[model samples]
Target: MDTTQLLKGVLDLAVLAVLKDEDGYGYDILRRLRTAGLDEVGDASVYGTLRRLFQAGLLNTYVVPSEEGPHRKYYGLNAAGRDQLNRAGKTWRNFASTMDALLDERGVAA
Candidate 1:
């Protein structure tokens, strides 16, 4: 089954979760997501998600000058973002549980 559609719906949550503990620059964030087993995550998608979240006032951004390369703009979760993460997490958990039950009932492996 194609996972792209499902991935689009949860990308925001994934991004928010990734930034929950620490701030990261674009490529850094992408790498972390890939390392976390989200290998299908694309660079542009993560970068765009950061920009969107920042524009939506859900993320904080700061620039750090690099000695070896260009300055990096890092994104971190703010109060609003945290609130969103908490709320969205609850919703996702509920949805996932429901889907799990449905799949089990249908004798389908989750």
Candidate 2:
């Protein structure tokens, strides 16, 4: 299975989950996700997801000044984002369990 492809489907959920803890700028969120084990997530993909989520009203963004560079746009989870995360989390748990069972069955059969 292509983990990267799978991750693409859940990238929005991942982004929202990260923002649920606190507001973060684009690069900051990307770094946090990478440090949390999503090493294969790309910068552009993360940035794009942020924009999309913001547009969809799931995220609220604000500007924070930076000493060494341009002001950064920080994102935080809105009420909708939080609700989405909760729903997605449930779906993911169920899907993961189903996949685990199927994989175990395949292993035994093999």
Candidate 3:
């Protein structure tokens, strides 16, 4: 299966989940996702998702000065984002369960 296609459907959820634990700048978030095993995740995808989530009012953004280089904009979840993450997580769990059952049955029944 093409994991990129699968990731597209859940990018919002994945981003929200990443911010659930801590705030992160765009590159930091992208790195965290990659470190967590989503090596195929696109840099543009994470940047776009951060912009979208901020616009949607699910995330809060603030800029921090960097003595070494350019300033960094960090994103953190607000109340709406937490609510969204909770709902999306439940939905994902349900969908994954059904898919797992179907796949398991197919293997045994074949």
Best by lDDT: 3
Return the lDDT, model 1, position 50.
91
- Show the lowest summed lDDT stretch of 10 residues, model 1: 1-10
Ten contiguous residues with the weakest lDDT in model 2 = 101-110
Question: Cα lDDT for residue 76, model 3?
Answer: 99
| Best of the two (1, 3) by lDDT | 3
Off by over 4 Å in 1: none
lDDT of 2 at 100: 87
Query: Model 3: how far is 33 from its true place, Å?
Result: 0.3
Clash totals in order:
0, 0, 0
lDDT of each: 0.93, 0.92, 0.94
TM-score ranking from best to worst?
Answer: 1, 3, 2
Let me know the TM-score candidate 3 reaches against the reference structure.
Answer: 0.95
Winning model by TM-score:
1
lDDT ranking, high to low: 3, 1, 2
Tens-place lDDT per residue, model 1, 2-76, is 778888899999999999999999999999888988888988999899999999999999999999899999999
For model 2, how does the per-residue alpha-carbon lDDT over 1-110 read when each residue is reduced to its tens digit?
46898989899989988988899999999999999899999999999999999999999989989999999999999999999999999999999899889989889553
Q: Report clash pairs, candidate 2.
A: none
Better of 1 and 3 by TM-score: 1
lDDT of 3: 0.94
